[model samples]
Target chain A: MGQKLTPGDSRSNLYNPQLGMTLIVKTVTRWVKGFIFLFGVYIVLYGHLTPGGGFAGGVIIAGAFILLTLAFGKEAALERMSKTVASEFDSLGALMFLMLAWLGLYFGGPFFVNFIQRNLPGKRFHLFSAGNIPLCNIAIGIKVGTSLFMVFIILSVLRVVVKKGERRMVQMKRRGE
Target chain B: MVTLLTVLLFFMVVGAIIAVETKDLLSSIICVGAVGFGVSIAFLFLRAPDIAITQVVVEVLVLVILIRATISRDVTAISGDREFFSMTVSIALLLVIFIFGLEVFKSFPQFREPVFTTMSDASTNTYIQRGLIQTGAANLVTSIILDYRAYDTLGEATVLFTAILGALAILRAKARKRTTDSSEGNSDQ
Candidate 1:
């Protein structure tokens, strides 16, 4: 639990729980998380042209959040992305991907067809050349990233319960009463 | 190249053995990660960059999740008859698999030869020739996954979605159980 704030006391650091690792870890994580997130976006956006795609990029993005949780504690990470928001993002990503596929059915011939005009004023190896592939990658990236982070957060928040006898024995030893 | 592959394979096998035999959970996880990385390197050497990338990222996520889930658990070493039996069974299975794989490999073409040498008009040739023109993507792998075999990719996405939903439901149910247990304890008091 975090420290409580009095009426006149500063509100800063009052809500962040004591759950993270050491100071060095927090500092390193702070510096690295942004770069990792940016790298993930890069992977997602350039999925068609690059080696990685949505799933790999999404996992990298989730890795950034996991690093934050590991170094700065679950509370700090959750403050940045709560359970509700993560779930919503997960759902939205999935829906967006599905809708893209549906667009093929509605506008184009078959399911998951390359509906959009693929040649969009870009060179062969340039970005924005792939039609619906990039869009799909972005949607899958968001969905996978949020879902994975949600799993990590939920798993980390689980409390380990000690047996009643063990708890009582520890308390009695400490109190000697 | 063959020697390099042999060395990498040797390292992968060693890592796998250490992963299985290590008593410390964290060390075991690291060993498994090493094995995964070795596999990724093999993929890269084989010119499968896309698979290598996916493998590496998946390995990282798996390691992170496993460590988080097992951090608080007991790391007791498994010993005794059951462990011995399992080990024996696994060794036997591995030997059988090795023999069977060698037999299967004998039926296939030589490793160094081009795989498409059997047919002049094979689908692989067609894929390489027209993959970029039809799909308009520079990366052949992307075009194959997203356009050529889109139905398979759709199936994969569906499977991923289903897995996430299942995980969420299971975690939520566990939380509900904990809450009900706490409420019952309070009412009893």
Candidate 2:
């Protein structure tokens, strides 16, 4: 219990317990990330009735993951959603969007036609009022959110590799000198 | 509104200059983020809440990415020898573009004015006048994007998908290894 400490000493393992930011950030994120994610879902679901739609909501969702990654390191964030799963979900989103359009085509209408709206238009200003819009918004939200997360994860991983490569180059140059 | 926009634009330009001229990569990223937030606020003043929200979140993510990439890799001595010359040339080009933009602004419509009602074509007018009844959506922008211009949304989604594919292809570790002897490449996998 009597461990001496100095400023900027990450090796102490007391102030810096893990491979992430301070404990305060991690604690705050644990409390706030769920709300951020839920707000993003709300924006996506109510996209047709509100100012934000799929893109905004999707970006918000990705922002939550990014915040988690920043606060708790990549390993914790990847535990929630691995890179492979993110990529697969990205593909699934695009496929779902395309399938929606193709279903419109198969139903004897033009591509992206509002067939559901024409047949059974629900009550106005309601959740299911727009025929294919909510579905499209969900698809786009899934696509944009997962792909952006993947992009962030990939870029961060690449940064590590780049740093290592640069260090190796510096070491080689010093050895040559 | 115009005054607010002018102030925001001025601050944004100042922030951009500071971001570009600074040597510290971290402070430069923060300055760029300030400029992005200013742009988001300007979007709000322009009555585009959708763009504003997207811009704010995207800006934060981009800032996080940029800072994470360059925070530990400080390269203060990497400035180009012709930095002053490049800066002068860019400023001159910007001034010329600003003059041309002012000329183009003369022919544009009034700010914040809905243009659909003034046009003679009644077909396009239906979206604004009867967008809710037709699409059963309250938000006109959402109805326009997901219904009236759905094919365009499809194209945008395809574009995003292609862009992510390109990013993954370029950034994957195994794809860049030309030789099998590199231990670093193997370890990454």
Interface RMSD of 1: 3.3
Model-by-model lDDT, in order? 0.78, 0.83
Which candidate tops DockQ? 2
**lDDT of model 1 at position A104:** 85
- For residues A93-140, what per-residue lDDT tens digits would candidate 2 score against the true structure? 889988988988888888888778888999988898988889989999
Interface C-alpha RMSD per candidate, 1 decimal? 3.3, 3.3
Q: In angstroms, how far off is B157's CA in candidate 2?
A: 1.5
lDDT of 2 by residue, B111-163 (tens): 76656657768566888788888888898888888888888888898888888
- Report candidate 1's fraction of native contacts: 0.50
Shift in Å, residue A87, candidate 1: 1.7
Best by lDDT: 2
DockQ class, candidate 2:
acceptable
What digit string (tens of lDDT, one per residue) describes model 1 on residues B78-100? Answer: 43335678879998999999999
